[model samples]
Target: MKPLNITYIYDYANLQVEEVRGSNISLKNRLAKLEQALRNKDELAENLHVIDFEQLKIENQQLNEKIEERNEELHKLRKKTIVTVQIITHMREKVQFVQKEYQILKEELAQLDQDLGAQRDLVTKTKHERDEHRQEYASLKQQTGIMNSEHLTKDFKDRAERIKELKELITQLKKRHSQMSQFIKSHGGVI
Candidate 1:
């Protein structure tokens, strides 16, 4: 049926019913008009249902569009989540690499500490040996002073031999220190 203004028909029906309630019009004529107005209002109401059906179609189309837009947004979010997961994986690898490097550095530091302890011990031993050599030299000097020329000459020879031995020991120590320096260089360590 063709669409028409339903409110106008409804209002006309209401006017007729009101007029019939208090007017001096003949009862039969008023009753006929009243019945015709009611029929017109019913027809208008049926036409109004077509408008409501069109509005419902528009509303359904809008809801479908909204659902499609929401689906597109969800896809974008899913892609972003995947990218975030990749970044997190790369960062995790970096953290593991750093941890391995740190562990290696820690081990090297421990080795250096042990070497330091050994060096300290060597320094202590060298000091004690120096003190003993000093005491021996002092004793020889006193003996030379108290003895005759022949005995003094013998003491001088003994002192010369001891000096040669000390020189040899110093040479050995220098070679040992050189070897240690080479070892440090090979291991990427500074002496």
Candidate 2:
């Protein structure tokens, strides 16, 4: 019986040792799988970091382009404003010049109107004087013609009276001559 007990105890001890060895092999396989999973997680984290960095760079470039476009638009607006101001100033100067010219022309026109009025007055006076002179000349001519007619009538009457006187003297001379001739014929009978 002691020998059989010793054999049974040795068989139980061997079985227990074999069970512990199987548990150790299973633990080693689980640890190897955990190490491989940790390595894969590290690789995935590195790829995500790179992707995030590229996305931030693209967003920064887009923001820069938008800022540049806004600056360009602002510059164009400033240039246009300057040009408009210059044009407005030029137009103002032209308007001022035109106004000055118009004022000068108006003054000149007023002076011309005054001159024309004076000239018209002078012409009217001269015409009145000319009409008076013409009337006077016509009156003088009529008066001269009347005086000449009166003088001619007086000369005709004087000539008619002188002719009558000469005829009477001739009649008296003939009578005297006839008497003298008869006396001489009677007294000279025998001389």
Candidate 3:
């Protein structure tokens, strides 16, 4: 009654040990499958990171090109502004020169006007003197005409009588001249 049989106990213990070993093997296989899945996930993440980095680099290049284009446009605008300013300055100078020339021309015109006024005065004086001389000549002609009329009236009839008497005298003078001519010829003088 005090000593139990140990052979049956040993057989039961052996059966339990076999079951524990089988369970341990199944757990190890499951852990191996989980590790392989983790490795695949890590590779997928690395590929996505590379794609994101490439996209970022392309966007940066595009932005840099746009900036360069804007800078070139700004430079052209600056050059155009400078040219416009220079043109404005040249125009201003030309306007000032024209103003000065206009002033000079105005002065010259004023002097010409004064000279013309003086010439006009001389012409007026000459015309007045000519008129006075014409009046004086007309007065002298009138006086001469009056004197001729008076002398003609005084001697008109007497001169006619004297012309008749002188005609008879001219006959006698012709007879005497003929006698004198014959006498001069006989005397050998120039007849």
Candidate 3's C-alpha runs over 4 A off are: 1-66, 144-191
- The TM-scores of all predictions, comma-separated, are 0.42, 0.37, 0.40
Looking at candidate 2, the ten consecutive residues that score lowest on lDDT are: 1-10
lDDT of 2 by residue, 1-191 (tens): 44568667888887777777777777777777777787777787678778877888898899899999999999999999999999999999999999999999999999999999999999999999999999998888788886657677798788888888887888888888888778778889443
lDDT of each: 0.90, 0.86, 0.88
The model with the greatest TM-score is: 1
Estimate, for each residue in 15-93, the C-alpha lDDT of model 1 and write its tens digit. 9888876574577678889999989988887787788788888999999999999999999999999999999999999
In what order do the candidates fall by TM-score, top score first? 1, 3, 2
Candidate 3 clash pair list: none
Q: Which residue pairs in candidate 1 have backbone atoms (N, alpha carbon, C) closer than 3 angstroms, thus clashing?
A: none
> Model 1 segments beyond 4 Å from truth?
1-45, 123-191
Give the C-alpha lDDT of model 2. Answer: 0.86
Global CA lDDT of candidate 3, please? Answer: 0.88
